[model samples]
Target: MASIETVTLEVADPTAADRFHTAAFGLGGQVRLRASEAPTTGFRGFTLSLVVSQPADVDSLVGTAVDAGATTLKPATRSLWGYGGVVQAPDGTIWQVASSSKKDTGPATRRIDEIVLLLGVEDVKASRQFYVDRGLAVAKGFGGKYVEFATGSGPVKLALYKRRALAKVAGVSPDGTGSHRIVIGGGAGPFTDPDGFAWEAASPALTN
Candidate 1:
């Protein structure tokens, strides 16, 4: 099955982004901060999710992010779905620290187990088809409201959502300007998704 390799954010300041990702989250250079010319920006059509092993990890991550210049949009709280919260990075990137597992599944060393890149698309059906056509399998999904794909053995999770719902989950306005798209590329040949997101074949240097 096709899966997203990595997410590259085109930001104005790569240095701050690098610092934020390192301090706020334990990401080690997987986030490529390319330069961008678009000035007026908003939600950027997506929000990143950090799936942790424990509920306490959610609080720890949220606190760490706040101390690292991230704004707490929502405090860590418990819900039936599990524990989770939202925060905005120094560069305005929305992140949700969450754990679906109710208890420790087993002894694990890693804190974050997965990174789900949730995309806001115009047509959910068309977007789902775009990835399905490109060899991604549907893990689970609603009719047109949302869709989550199966990214077996891949670190990143790819999901589709209505633009407004995506914005609501991140606690931000859906409208935005500039290049507000994520390049879930590097694993497949170069092509543009239905919503204008770009993808390029995986580079040998970036492969982990």
Candidate 2:
């Protein structure tokens, strides 16, 4: 079995891609692409490469339908975490831009390392069971609501919290059923844990 290794996000706008990097994710650096590098179409690059989408030319269409509103974080610059920047798209969509050297370049590769992807759920027990039934192994933590699951892909941590509670953390109430939608590698979809925490999941965007 593979460990949780890489994650990616395919963004539309170059600006919002910047916001997700610096402001929200606290990353620094703008990973420059070389002609030798291969092209990617999903969050895999952003998560693993720590690289942002090209300023202009990219194969994929990077746009968020959630209308999460747009906000700039800082001037893009090079940093230890690859290309670091931030941008808030329409509908208050916040994105952290960064890549990691720990991404898989193979077509159907499995993860070998561990990186915890935090997800908010209303019922930790139910969420745990959901993954467990899917062949994920569950481990209890000191925090009651905290449950760790071994998603064959990697370590996906589900944090249980009430909708209102998570909303408070986001400093806003739940928007709509599909309020925050983000496109990943192939099939774009909206995912909100039981607590209404919205996010997009797919392969890693950039190379390791």
Sequence-dependent TM-score of model 2: 0.40
Question: Candidate 2: which stretches are off by over 4 Å?
Answer: 1-3, 10-15, 18-91, 94-116, 141-144, 150-160, 179-205
Model 1 over residues 116-164: C-alpha lDDT tens digits?
A: 8888998999999988888888999999999999988767788899989
Q: Estimate each model's TM-score.
A: 0.89, 0.40
Report model 1's TM-score to 2 decimal places.
0.89
| Residue-wise C-alpha lDDT for candidate 2, range 159-207, written one tens digit per residue | 3343444343333443334322222221122343344333343444343
Q: What local distance difference test score does each model get?
A: 0.80, 0.35
Task: Tell me the lDDT of model 1 at 40.
Answer: 49
